[model samples]
Target chain A: MPIARGYAATDASKPLTPFTFERRNPNPDDVVIDIKFAGICHSDIHTVRNEWKNAVYPIVPGHEIAGIVSAVGSDVTKFKVGDRVGVGCFVDSCIGCAERDLDREQYMPGLAGTYNDFEADRKTRTQGGYSDSIVVREGYVMSIPDNLPLDASAPLLCAGITLYSPLRHWNAGPGKKVAIVGMGGLGHMGVKLGAAMGADITVLSQSLSKKEDGLKLGAKEYYATNDPETFTKLAGTFDLIICTVSAEIDWNAYLGLLKVDGSFVVVGAPENPIPVHAFSIIPGRKSISGSMIGSIKETQEMLDFCGEHNIVSEIEKINIQQVNEAYERVLKSDVRYRFVIDIASLAA
Target chain B: MPIARGYAATDASKPLTPFTFERRNPNPDDVVIDIKFAGICHSDIHTVRNEWKNAVYPIVPGHEIAGIVSAVGSDVTKFKVGDRVGVGCFVDSCIGCAERDLDREQYMPGLAGTYNDFEADRKTRTQGGYSDSIVVREGYVMSIPDNLPLDASAPLLCAGITLYSPLRHWNAGPGKKVAIVGMGGLGHMGVKLGAAMGADITVLSQSLSKKEDGLKLGAKEYYATNDPETFTKLAGTFDLIICTVSAEIDWNAYLGLLKVDGSFVVVGAPENPIPVHAFSIIPGRKSISGSMIGSIKETQEMLDFCGEHNIVSEIEKINIQQVNEAYERVLKSDVRYRFVIDIASLAA
Candidate 1:
């Protein structure tokens, strides 16, 4: 067994504190990674604070993981020592399960989350990556392409794949007008990815504060949702609108912005239900859908696509000790984009 | 001008009464039809009683029409005297407009409702097929196939296309498992049409009250949505769900029954917005969409398909005088399927 040191919330009310735990001995298909950078996701805060109310204490919450493969089990064929890789929201799912058989492991009922979830054995709680090292099955680990900095690529594991899956599923490409709602980590990645995918991109933010940054990130237009005219002027304009705002928005108004046969996809989830009228979708044959993070295969493809397009999350690097302060900024939406924790600081 | 006798609602508070109106003289591109039968849609009841709140007084509400072409204008090359024909929700849209040019006239802002709405001239209040006759542009009139009876085909004009458009738009066909919610007029059409399209049909009614009828209408299975186990057993089972009930439902529970990438399509408009959690659509990438009645082109296609398959509405025939009684029954969902008025009663 390898000893790993990380930070964890002992209870919902407390900040994450340094803790040492034993990682499982590598299975035949496992890859042991020396975590270089771990991206802090909004979900991490939600889980640690038990805002979603399902969090387990003593939880090490980080799923946006990027690292170098330090060792591989005897039967690990996909990765070699020193290979750059990453892991997303989950580390394992029962391979022969129905959802996995259909290549939809992310939705599998038996999926083991990277943190606060029991592994396939149902006895051991699988911990996550806010750590110095993580042991993952070869299949769950994704290769980070060269030239993309490890810190910037970390968020791609979560935010990148979250946006990429829907854009591809809905066929957001050339001649497609896509609007990304909110200018946070997920929405910013949506702009870069949607623009890279040849879509005419627009950023729909709460205000014009992020207008300059959004446009520079490949948005052709930026509109403030607080301004009523934004809704009026852009009515029935977009072929696809990816709502990255976790707050409950006026869903019907956004549905109105979709053209005939367009889709409004939600990636960010609010606690309560969003109310929508049949009139909004019926008149134009519009649809409202939601997507979670991509499957391992699709996640790899997203990373490769990023490699080709030079896409990486705009990240604020933070020392491991700065995580508590970073969480505060994330809650206020004050971060430039994403915050990636330097895992080496844990070693020191 | 031609004198047209019909039943009309004098106000929202009273029963429909015998009233007289004038039919427009034929325009150069018009087809004047001597009305034979008119289907009483739920919308007619909604309009007459001000349930939808947009009704203009003395409204003669009927749109699902079946009749004979009594006259044709000089440029009406499509129809001649005594030709069997039908007209649906609208009589005309702004011709040569972008949407009308594409044959999607129903979505056009200038679409003229068959009753209570001003004609394209913006001055004349358009009457409907409940009258003895109607004069409509030739392009908007559909030719009823020789094999289909005019009375039974009346509901096919409104109810048929309403289901067919969404069923087709969502690609309901062979290998697709389609669930038709609500077994009323619109839903029965969905059952017939979805079955004819080679889909594995299921009817999800409020209870097994219509189980025999549903199976007879070609549904392979019938489930009572009132049964909790039905939701559990059929979880993620359907590829398409067409909700024809105008009443608000537990939208999230229904959304849970869809398979990955499936759609819950609403053809019926409810008075209020439905609350849906982001969890319903996100994990499975499921969608909630809505479809109105088809385009003129698709309506023709639906009719052609119906004709080819010998499909028509299961109707209860009523004289125009009984329409008020029919309205009461419609509100109670007491009709076998649909009611088609004998327009000849108006002539009497």
Candidate 2:
């Protein structure tokens, strides 16, 4: 057994506190990683508080992980000791199912989450990268480019792939008009990645407060969604709009912003069902879709794409002691973008 | 002026009565059609009863029209004076707009409905195919294949194209698993067309009462939506699901039946907005979209396809005098599939 030190929530009502747990021994195809930086995703907050209603007790919630390979099992060929690496939302999935494709395993059945889930054996608990050390299958481990720092690059594991997958899937390259709704952690990355892909990017934020930041982050235009004229002026404009907000907004109005045959994809989830009128998508033959995080292969490709574009998330670094306070600020949308935890602080 | 006689709704509350209206004088680009058969669509009932709230009174409600060419303008090169023809949902659109494609004019703005709408002049009211005669632009007329009879082929102008457009758009063909979500007029056509396209078809109706009819029409399987087990048994089973019923049902439940990267397309309109949970699509990267009727170009393709396959709507022919009673039966889903009115009875 490998002892791992981390912070975890023992119950839904309590804040995460220092805890120590034993990690499973490395399997033949596993790679042991010395977790360097962990990004505090909104999903982490949701899990710690059991907001999604599926959280397991003593859950160490982190999925956006970036680190260095400390050890590798005998059969692990893709990763070696001292290599920079990363892990995302899942650690394992059904490997041999006929429906499982190498490039789309994230959407398949039997996906084991990095935390709050059981491993393939269905007996061993799988903990995430909030810990000081994590062991993941070599196949799920991604390589982080040397130029992108681990702290800022941590959010790319989850936030980057969430936006990048839909953008690439919908063909958001040259001559494409893409809109990224919301100006938060996931959205700011969409602006950067979409603009890097040669797409004309626009930010539809609740207010113009982040217009300067949005424009600086490679957006060609920024509009305040609070104004009614925003809807009227931009009706039937975008080729694709990736909504990154979890708030209950008028989905029909956004559907109106797409041109004929355009798509509106949702990456963030609201608490309740959204009301959508058929006429919203009927006249233009538009679509409303949802995308989760990308597959392991695509996530690595995204990392390589970021390397070529010199892209990394705009992150605020904090020590492990300040994570509980960071959750409150995140709820208020007070962070500039993402908050990354320095794992070395855990050892101290 | 050309005199035309048809049954028209004088007001929202009263039954349709015999009314005489003037057809526009032939333009240099017009083709005059002598109406022979007209298919009664649900939209006609909705418009005549003012259910959609946009009906112009004295509306002549028919768009699924089959007829013969009584006259052709000097510039008409596609049709002769005695050619078999059909007129669908719209007779004119913004023909020269930048967004208008020759293959997708039905989704564009400035579309002139075949009935209850104005022509390009914006002053002359466009009455539809429920009349003794109709004057239409040569560009909007489609040639009916010689093998199909005028009455049985009438619904292809509307119902056939409505199902055909989305099936082709979503790539429902060989090796594809498709489910038609209703077994009414539009869905029965979907079953035949999807099966013709070499895709395996299934029917998900409210009850298994029509299971025998579904199988006879080429469905591989039939499931009753009213049975809860159907949802569980067919979860993640379809590659494409085309919903043709306008009644509000559990859209989320239907969405769960799609495979990864699958699409759920809507051709029917419900009066109110439907509530959809984000989880319904996010997990599978699924989509919910809408498609109206096809353009004149694709409508011609559908007619040619139907001709080759020997396909026609399963219709119950009724005299024009019985249309008011037919509307009541349609509201109750009592008709076998469609009711084609004998336009010769209009001249009696």
Candidate 3:
């Protein structure tokens, strides 16, 4: 057993605080990783505050994890000591279903969250990567390319793959026009990935506040969604629109922004049901869809693509002690893009 | 100009009455069809009663037109005297746009409604096929297959293509499990078309009252949506679902019926917005999309396919005088599939 130091939300009202826990020793197929960097995802905030209503108490929430392989069990063949790796949103799913056979394991009905849920044992609760170390099955771990730095690539495990899967599924490439709604953590990755996939990228944000950053991230155009004229100007313009905002907007108005046979996809779930009109999609053969974080295989593909294109999340690295303040900044949409916690700070 | 006698709704509150109007004499590319049958669609009732809020008074409400081409202008290449033909929801659209170039003219911004809307000239409200005759450009008219009957195939012009386009676009075929979420005019066609496409079909009606009819129409399974167990038992069961109901439903419940990457499509617009939860689609990579009456090219393909499959609307034939009564029955969903008016009855 390894003694792991991490931050946990003991209850909904209190801030995350230092907690000491014990992680199981590596099993035959397990690889123990010394977690170097962990990205603070919006879901972490939701879980810590019990917003989604199913959050288990004493939750140590982090899934966008990047680390170095510290130890390997006897059956671990893919990595040895000192290898770089990452683990994303989910730790395991039912592996015998047809979806698993298709490598779309995230859709398996028995999927287990990386944190705030019981592991396959159905009794021991699974913690997350805010800790100093983690032990995961070999198949659940992904190899990070040497060219990509761990701190910046941390968010790529979650936000990066979330955007990448939809872009690839919808065929966002040459001759395609794509719009990324919101300029926060997930959306910024969409602009970069869409552009890298040869799409004409446009950013639909609440304001021009992030125009320069969006352009720098490979977006060819940016528009403020709050401006009425923006809707009129871009009506029927996009082949694919990926909405990363977790708040509900006039979904029908955004549906008008798509061309015939276009798709509007969401990566974030709003608290309330989104009101959509059938005519908005029916008139043009349009679609409104949603995607979760990528499958493990797709997540690995996203990392490799990012490495090939020199793409990594725009991150604001902070010490583990600054996590509470970082969460506040995140709620205010004040972070530049993403916040990466330096796990070494947890040890001190 | 040619004088045409038909029934027209003079206002939202009144019954349709006898009216006489003039249709333009053939232009160089025109074909004048003497309407032999007109299917009374729910939309015809909606437009006549100003339900969609865009109806113009004195509207002749019919779009599912089947007729004999009686006249053709000098340059009319597609239709000649006595040719069997059909007309659908729209008469014309902005013909030079990229959408038109792609044969998706129905999505053009300047699309002209078959009735209660101005033509391409932007004035002179176009009367619908409820009239004795209609003059349209040759390109806008589709040739009815020789083996199909004029009365039963009339609804195929609109309802048939509406379902066919989405099923084909979503790739519903062998090995796919499809569900049609109503058993009315459009839904019956969906079951027939989806099954004929080699997909296994299920009917998710509000009651098992239609179970026998659904099975008779080639559905392999029929479930009553009113049963709570139906939702639970069929969860994650379908690859594609086409919703033809125009009433608001708890759409998230139906989204649960889809498999990973499945589609839930709507062809009818409810007056109120459809509330959708992002989690419903995001967890499974599912989609909520809509399809209108298809492109002219696709409509022709649908008619040809229906011909090959021996498919046509299950129509209840009536005289012109029975139209008002039919409208009331349509409102109650009491018609056995569709209602087609025998045009010769108008001569009295």
Candidate 4:
């Protein structure tokens, strides 16, 4: 067993602090990763605070992971000691299920979360990417493209794939119009990815504050949703509207923005139930759907796509010691887009 | 102008009474139909009583119409005198739009409802098929198959096409497991259409009171939604669930019955907004969608399909004088399936 140093949430009300734990001894199919960077996602904050009411005590919370392979088992053939790799929201799934066999393991019944969950044995607890190092099944690890830097690429493991899967599933490409509902971490990635896919992209943010960044990042238009005219001007405009904000808003008004037979997809998990009128979708033959993170295979494809398009999250790098402050800023919507933690600070 | 005799709703609180109106003179592209049967739909009750708040006084509310062509304009090519015919929810749409050009006129703007709405000129009040005769453009009329009787085939114009459109749009066929919620007029049609399309069909009704009827109407299984065990047993069981009940129920519970990537479509209109938890659809990548009645082309396809399969609504025929009583029974769900008004009673 190898000693792993990381920040752990020991209590729901307290800040994360340094803790040391033992990593599992490598299995024949496992690869050991020396974590280089970990992005701070909103879900990490929720798990640490027990807001979802399912967190395990002393949970190590980080899923957007980018790192270098420190070691590999004898049977592992996909990576060498120096290969760049990443781990996303899940670490393992039921091996023989149809979803797993089709490379769509994210939706499998027996999926094991990277953290706050038990492994296949149901006894061994699983930790996540907040650590200095991690041991993952070779099948769950994705190879990072060489052109993308580790720090900026971390969020792609989660946010990038969240937007990519829906875009591809709904056939967003040339001649299709896509609208991203927020300008935060997940939504910014949607703009870049949708634009790279050749679709005309728009950002529907709360105000005109992020209009410049949105345009620079690939959105062709930016509108202030707070303005009443925005709704009227964009009525029946988009082929797809990807809602990335968890905050409650008028979902029916947004549904009105979609073209006939268009879809409204939700990536963010809102706390309250969404109140949608049956007439909202019925008149246009529209749909309101949901998407989770992508599978292990799709994540790889997303990373490859990002590499080809030179797309990465606009991030602010922070040390492990500043994580609590970063969380507060995240709550206030103060981060530029994302916050990535440099793992080298774990030693300090 | 030709004098048309029909029952009309003069006030919101009063019972319908006999009324005489004038029909537009035939144009070069017109067909004059002598209505034989008009099916009683819940929408008719809503409109006449002003439940939807958009009723036009003296409105003759019937869209599920079956008739015979008494005369055809010089330019009519599809039908001759004495040819069987039918008319559905709409009479005209904006010409040259993409939706109309694609034969999907139901979703096009400027759609002229068959009743309680104005004609293309926006001045002529378009009365529906409860009358003895109706004058319509040839493009808006459909030719009924010779084998199917006019009375039983009446509801196919509305109830039949409502379910058929979603079944085809969602690819419900062999290997697909479908659930039709509510076993009323709309849902019963769904069971027949889905089974006829080769999909495994189930009925999820409030109680098992209609279980035998559901099973006899092409459903492979029936379950009482009031039973807690039904939800647990059928979790993730359906590829598609078409909700036809306008009453409020737990939508999240039904969303749980869908398999990964499955859809729950709505053709019924609930007065209040449905409250759905985001988690219900997020985990399985499921969707909640809506479908209206079929387009002119698809409605014709549905009728032709029903004809080939020997399918027709199980209807209780009533004379025109009993329509007011039929409306009361319909509100109580007392009819076996549907109520078809015999137009000959108007002359008697």
Candidate 5:
């Protein structure tokens, strides 16, 4: 067993505090990573506060992890000591792996989550990426591009891939008119990746507050969705609308902007059910859909695409001690984009 | 003006009665068809009863018509007086007379429906195929293949194209598992077309009453949605589900059957709104979409494919006088598949 340190919330309402933990020795296909950076995902906040009712406390919540490989078991072919690697929302999946068929192995009856989920033995609790070190299967760990800085690449495991998966799956490319709703962590990445994929990108935000930032991220157009004229002007315009905001927008208003057979892909999963009118999808033969993060193969593709395109999140690096304050700022939509933690501060 | 004979529903609740009307004189780009057979679509029922609330009565409700061209304008190069031409759904679209992105054009804001809709001028209300003669622009008229008899090809216009559009759009082919919901006019066609497209087909009906016919139409599996075990045995099994039934099914239950990012395309639209939990779509990355009839290009493609495949809807051919009884039978789900009206019966 290896002693490790991380910031954890012992109770739902409490701020994170320094906690000690243990990591099991690496198996033949496992690699031990010394965590350098961890991204503060919205899901971490939700789980830490028990907002989603699945938080098991003394929870060290972080899934977007980037680090240096410190050790590898004999059979670990993908990584060697000193290599940079990253872990995303999941750590271990079904043994069958059942490569890349939506609900087949991982998320269906035979899946595992990064934190608060039982390991393959169904007895060991799987600790997440916020810790100083983690032992993960080599197949679950990805090679982080050398050109991409570790801190900047942390959120790619979550925010970057969440947007990338849908855009790629929906065929966003040259001549495709794509819209990204909201301009926060996920939205900004959507704009950047969409542009990188050669799509004509548009940003639809609450006000024009993020208009300048949107254009800087390669958006061809920006509009305030709050304006009534926005709906009128953009009616039947977008071929695909990727919504990344967690809160509910007026869905009918969004549905009105879809062209014939257009899709509204929801990455913004709110706790409440979305009250959707069937009529919204009827007239123009539109679609309402939702997408989760990418598969292991797709994540690699996203990483390669990012490496080639020089794309990374506009991250605000914070010390481990500022995590609680950062959470409040994140809730208020005050962060520039993502807040990544410098994991060394956990030792202090 | 050419004095034409047809059937019109004078009021919302009354059965359609024999009536006399006038079609416009053939324009330079027009072809006049001597209507032979008209297939009854669910939309025809909706229009005659004003159930969609947008229907204009004394409406002539028909869009699937197969006939011989009786007259052609001097500049109409596509069709001659004796050619077999068929008219379906929308006869005129905003991006008129062009096949480039015709699906986009079909639902364009100002696109006109074949019947019970105001024409391009916004003054003349266009009648439809349930008549003795129809003068249509050459662009909207398709050539029916010689192998597919006119009686059988009538339903091919509406029912055939509706299923073909979604099946092809969703990539239903060899190695793909496709499910057709319901066994009515559209559903039967879906099964035959999906099977002919080289996909493994399944039928989800209310009961096993249509099981034999479903198998004969190319279904590899037949299950009743009402049976509790149907979901358990086939959960996460299908790649594409073309929902031909308009009434709401258990969305999450059906969603559970999709194999990650799989699509359920709704061809039959229900009147009421469906309550969908965002979590249903989010977790599996599944989609629920609606499709209207196909474009003229795809309709021709569908007819050609049907002609080569020797595919047609199982129909009960009736004189125009039996349309009232046919509607009652359709409402009861008594018709085997579709009802085709012999237009010459109107002159009796």
Candidate 6:
């Protein structure tokens, strides 16, 4: 067994503290990653608070992982010692699930989560990258671009692909109009990607708090959805609308803003049900849909797309000890975009 | 002006009565159709009772018009005297307006309705095909194939296209699993067209009342949605579902029946909002959207497709005098499928 040290919340209402755990010894297909940075995502907070009832206790909640390969097993050919890498939401999956194509291995059917989850055997609890190091299968590990700093690149594992997968799937490109709802960590990536994809991008935020930032990120327009004019002015306008917020929204009203055969894709994970109206989808042939995180192949493609377009998330760096404080700030929407933990601080 | 005769409901509470009205003379681009068969859609009943308040009364509520081209204006090249013709939901749109494509004119903004509507001048109330004759633009009128009977083909104008557009748009074809959520008039058409398009069709009806009928009409399976086994047995199975009934349904429950990236297309007009859970769309990338009646171009294709497949609505033919009784029977879903009034009965 390999010992690892990380911060975790033992209870739903508690703050993070030091926790000791053991990782399995390197299998021939595994690579031990010295996690350089871990992003403090909203899901981390959700898992720590046990908002999802299935959350395991002593939960080491971190999924957005950015790191370097310190060691690789004999059979791991995808990465080598000193190679930069990142591990996203899941660390293992059924590579041959029928739903997946031959080129890409299907994930999440029996795949182990980075934290608070079990492997296929369901006995050993899988810890995550809030720790100083993580061991992942090479097939699940992806190469990080050289230009994107490790700290700033952590959120890309989760937020970046969450936005990119839907936009690309829906064909966001020249002559298309795209709207990014909410200006939080996920929304910001959608704005950057939508703009980089050559779409006429607009921001539909709660208010105009990030109007200037959105335009600076290449958005042509930004509107406060709280304002009545937003709905009237942009009615039947957008070809694609990507929602990144997790709170409950008026889905029917939001769907009303779509054009004929338009789609409103949700990356948001609200706790409640999404209420809809038949007329909302009927008149213009609009649709409301949801997307989860990307597959390994698409995640690599997203990173490549970002690297080619010079699109990187605006990240705020923090020490591992400040993670609980960062979570508090995130709840208040205080971070510039994302908070990435410097794992070196854990060692210190 | 030309005097036209039809049945009209003067008030919401009153039964339809024989009424005489006047229509403008055929314009340069108009084709005067001597209405032969007018299909009684559930919507017509809803409109006469003011269930759909948007209806403009002293309403002559008929849209599924199949007739002979009694006369054509000087510029009319598409239809001539003695040609079989049909007029669907909308008669005149902003003809040359920017909202319309010259090829696909129905998508045009400020689209005009077929009947129970105002003309471009916004004052003259337009009467529909329940009358002895109707004058529509050459662009809006479609040619009915000579092989199909007029009464059987009447519902294809609205009910057929209503299902066909969504099925085609969503790519319902070989290897696709489709479900039609009602076994009434529109749902039956969905089953037929979906089968014609080469998809495995399933009918999700309230009970097994129409099971054998559905199978005869090209459905591979018929299940009572009222049974709990139906949900459990077919969870996450469909690629496209055309909801053709006008009642409010469990949007979330229906959404669960879809596979990843699957869409639940709404053609039925519901009186209330359907509550949805974001979770349904989020986890599997599912969608819920609505569709209106098809464009004139697509309607022609639907007519041609039905002709090729030898498919037509199962209809009960009645004289104009029985239109009131047909309305009552439609409310009970007592008719086999559709009730098409023989327009020639109006002359007697």
State interface RMSD in Å for all models. 0.8, 0.7, 0.7, 0.6, 1.9, 1.7
Q: What local lDDT does model 4 show for residue A52? A: 96
Tens digits of per-residue lDDT for model 6, B86-149: 8999887776654465444555566768777876667878888899998888988998988899
Q: Score the docking of each candidate (DockQ).
A: 0.85, 0.90, 0.88, 0.91, 0.56, 0.73
**lDDT (10s digit) by residue, model 3, range A1-348:** 788999999999999999999888779989999999999999999999998899788999999999999999999999999999999988878877788888889877788788998777777788998999988888899999999999999999999999999999999999899999999999999989999999999999999999999999999999998899999999989999999998868888999999999999999889898888878887888899988888888999999999899999999999999999999999999998999999999867
Per-residue CA lDDT of model 1 for B1-348, tens digit only, reads 899989899899999999898887788999989999999999998888998789888898899999999889998898999999999998778888777767677887788898989987989998888888898998889989999999999999999999998898889999999999999999999999999999999999999998999999899999998889999999989999999998878899999999988899998999999787999988888899988897888899999999999999999999998999999999999998999999887656
Q: What are the TM-scores, per candidate, against the unseen true structure?
A: 0.98, 0.99, 0.98, 0.99, 0.94, 0.97
Distance (Å) between predicted and true CA of B32, model 1? 0.7
Candidate 2 DockQ vs. native: 0.90
| Model 5: lDDT of residue A108 | 55
Q: Is the docking of candidate 6 incorrect, acceptable, medium or high quality?
A: medium
lDDT, candidate 1, A172-208, per-residue tens: 9999999999999999999999999999999999999
Please write out the lDDT profile of model 5 over residues B1-348, one tens digit for every residue.
898888999889899998789888789989999999999998899888988788777788899899999888889998898998799988777664333455555556676788998766788888987899988889889999888889889999999999998899889999999999898999999999999999999999999999999999999999999998999999888999988887877877887888877887777877666666777888778888877788788899999999899998899999999999999999899998999999988878
User: Once superposed on the true structure, which residue ranges of model 6 sit more than 4 Å away at CA?
Assistant: A102-108, B96-99, B102-104
Model 2, range A75-158, lDDT digits (tens) per residue?
Answer: 999988999999999999998776465478889888999999999898888888788999999988999999988889999999
Residue B8 of model 3 has an lDDT of 97
How big is the positional error of residue A125 in model 2, measured in Å on the Cα after superposition? 1.2
State which candidate, 1 or 2, has the greater lDDT: 2
Model 3 bad stretches (over 4 Å): none
- Cα lDDT for residue B68, candidate 6: 94
- Give all candidates' CA lDDT scores: 0.92, 0.93, 0.92, 0.94, 0.87, 0.87
Off by over 4 Å in 5: A95-97, A100-109, A275-279, A282-285, B95-104
- List per-candidate RMSD values in Å: 1.3, 0.9, 1.3, 0.8, 2.5, 1.6
Error of 5 at A280 (Å): 3.4
Candidate order by decreasing DockQ: 4, 2, 3, 1, 6, 5
What is the C-alpha lDDT profile of model 4 across B223-331, one tens digit per residue?
Answer: 9999999999999899999999999998999999999999999999999998879999889889999999989989999999999998899899999999999999998
